[model samples]
Target: MPEDVEDPMDYIRLHLLEKLQVLLTTAALLAVVYFGLGRWFRPADPLGPIALLPGGELGKLLGIVVVLLVLAAVAAAATTRSRPEGALMTALFGLGGVAMLSPPMQTLFWSYPASMQSLYLQMMAEVLIFAVGIMLAEGLGGLVRSFMAKICPRWLWTNTLSELSDQQRKTLKKSRIDPMWDKNILNGDSLSVSSGVRNTLLWNLLSLSLHGKNRTAAQKQVFRGQLHRGFGCLFSGVLAGIVLLVLLLQSPERGQILFALFGSFVLAALFAHHLFPVRTFFVAWMIPMLTAVLFYALAAISGTGNRPQYQVLPIDWLTGGAGGAILGFWLSGRWREIRIFEALAQAPPE
Candidate 1:
């Protein structure tokens, strides 16, 4: 007789139901944003341009419904931990958000008589775009890294144990060591560890916890190698910001420019901070804000002659940038710590 034989199907069913609930909740939230809130805040003019898209208002409504459905599906797929599923979701959400703000949609909505009201609509649209962009960057980061690993030069790719043979990988798995730790192993010609203590924080933390005494030289070397791959998040944020700015520039209003600049900065900052695994909230939070400020200053200097003057109050930056920085820092810390706990749990007992 099989001892302690639990039915795996029960666990599978439980997980399936949990996932379904999450999907349903996400779909409901999206529906509220698209239908309830959207209608409540819609412009006073019933026959606005957005209302006149092919098939009229009903068509636009249906389009939103379709998009929401797609988003819900993507959200569910993202739970699977599958790279292709995540990549597809990322592309679909990111591109769909951008498409929603295309020229035709803008032309339709911008015709509202109340400028402030129209600006509100634009702002909401931009928020959706930013949200999707962050999701895409996060979801696609690993996929992009894996793809690069395959094509990158031998010297570059060999630094990580991701190139380990099947037997070696299996051995590591049996020992309860996460494959992700392989990212920190240096197999290249150089003997020294990668620069920057922050780069190997997670590896070091894990190594010290798992093997307090008699740590091997190879283990120490692995801890020194850089592991976190964050370029995808940065690239996605920048690309999405550019697309949003281009759309906003269609209207040369000062409000539009200010909103676009602030929104883009927050979006980029959030993604970058989230991707970085630093424990110091202050460092992670400030990096993105500082980067954004530098970029803003550069833009200001370059366009000094041609750009229209807008009085940018200090409070604006403090409120927007600080708020986003704090949120991103908190979220990243929470998520990173959760993964650490999971890894710790999997470690072999002393």
Candidate 2:
């Protein structure tokens, strides 16, 4: 088993009922937000419940998506350790949340009414808010990971003489591992030696403690450093989206603004794929999800902007967030092999 298995889902085998409860609880929370947002942002002369292509029809399609994938999650739960199950759950919950787009969320309005142009602007702005917020949360998680690292070094343990293969011995020779750890801790044929240190992580959600000294320390640093770089991707994405939103806001043909929005998502996803090294991609996607839940409260406080009066289907915040999340998960993964690929591709300047 890969040592990176510290997330809540890792405990599925340990606590099946708790994981089930968590899933159901998330679904229940989203349900509350669904009808609650429906009433809060409903139109004055409300549109029919079953109306518009992107409204009810798109929701039905997403509902189909949720149903199909949820079964996948159930099967994944039955496994000993399904690595992809985490990603599957991320997609399921992300899409499941977005699948509940009601008429209220579909049609937005400001202090006055929102023009078609303003609606696109508002939508893109919501995307920015979500993109930034998720990255910020991730960065915070990273900080917590690094903080836990100081305590982790105390729990360090080393493997024995027989445990070290020819390859492992060669690996150990070049590193900073203490000779004392290997010599003083030896007894007979035991593989590893442990002192009076707790082997579990202080916070599993942020950092998972691995079984060995080298692997745990190495992966924790990877988690800290790699997660920090996601902000660069986040900055690039936010900047690209903002610049496009500004330029398009002035254009006479407002439909073109969606191209900017689409391009923004595509560009951001590409940057993250290339740059944000993921020991785990599920968290990257998971962070940016529930955009509607994250931002609807803000919209309520600031007052509404653009409430669509027609039988129109404006793409809501969830579209960018949900779609972006799925795309991010699909595109990103561990970067170790990527480094090898880079080393082989070309040489550095002399």
Candidate 3:
């Protein structure tokens, strides 16, 4: 096989190991923070009274185990070809995380000593906010994309395609030379190539058009068209961030709430990049950062008395947005590969 064509089993094994490492590392860090450092950072629980089991420390350990199991399941599911299943699992995990963090549930299940309650609450709150943000952004962005694809002007898609470089166009054309190309590529109804070469070509073409240097006039036109379409996602992300901000405002920890807002913005942008046809990294990163900054500026200007100091730092914003964008790009590529695999699996035997 070509070096670029990875065996599916190898891919699965490599990613599964990575996920396990991440899961283990995260669990260990959490344990250290909760058990080792909890006393040092103890404060009043901002989330207020939480439920706790009668079993004390042992019960908390069990609950933590359950949470880890859920996370493991999510990670495993994410590596599979079933995007819907992965997304559903993620949503469920998010919901469960939030419920577990709730005051009643926290009191009932969590074993944090009174001194550590504040720190525990803070940790769980961060997890809950991230989960909720991801669920909402991905779900809402997908819905919006589907809706827009149906009603949006044809010019957008056409212009975007027209922007492809000659080389990229040739690659696309070459991929479509097969007998079943019309039933697949043109219709956008099915995958045609058994090797996934077509999908790879398409992905590379788009990436080059969006990110490659020395773009021709046509490529620039495509970039503009993509930018226009990407505005829909930009709007969607901003709206989602605003909603998260409002929800977070209800929480007692104002600083953490703003942090969640920033997180939501990043998630929104990542979801938008993954779901929308526009594949540009600039759009993926800048839209969310700009949206957050714009909202923050407006809030600062409008507020009375001392201007509210924005809690989100530039380093945090850059890191989060860039990380999310890179992940989105990677996922997009993986999805293309998966699509090719499926198409090949379904194609009639020679």
Best by lDDT: 3
Query: lDDT of candidate 3 vs native?
Result: 0.38
lDDT of 3 by residue, 1-350 (tens): 12322455544554454344434533543454345433322224544322222222334433433443344344323322222222222322332322223332233224433334343333333333333333333334234323433554321111122232344333443454333222223322222111111122234456666667777766565555555656765676556555655555354333453355445655565566445544333344445456445544553454311222233322233333333443453355345545443343334433
- Give the clashing pairs for model 1: none
Ranking by lDDT: 3, 1, 2
Model 1 ranges off by over 4 Å: 1-266, 273-276, 305-315, 336-350
Kindly report which residue stretches of model 3 are placed more than 4 angstroms away from their true locations once superposed. 1-10, 14-225, 229-232, 252-255, 305-316, 319-337
Candidate 1 global Cα RMSD: 16.3
How many clashes in each candidate? 0, 9, 8
Q: Per-candidate TM vs. native? A: 0.29, 0.38, 0.39
Look at candidate 3 and tell me the lDDT of residue 7: 50
User: Against the true structure, whose TM-score is highest?
Assistant: 3
**Per-residue alpha-carbon lDDT of model 1 for 24-103, expressed as tens digits?**
54445445444444453233454332322221344444444444435534443333322122222232223222222222
Better of 1 and 3 by TM-score: 3
- CA lDDT, candidate 3, residue 276: 51
lDDT of 2: 0.35
- Clashing residue pairs in candidate 2, if any? 108-306, 108-307, 109-304, 109-305, 109-306, 109-307, 110-304, 110-305, 110-306
Q: Tell me the lDDT of model 2 at 130.
A: 39
TM-score, cand. 3 vs. native: 0.39
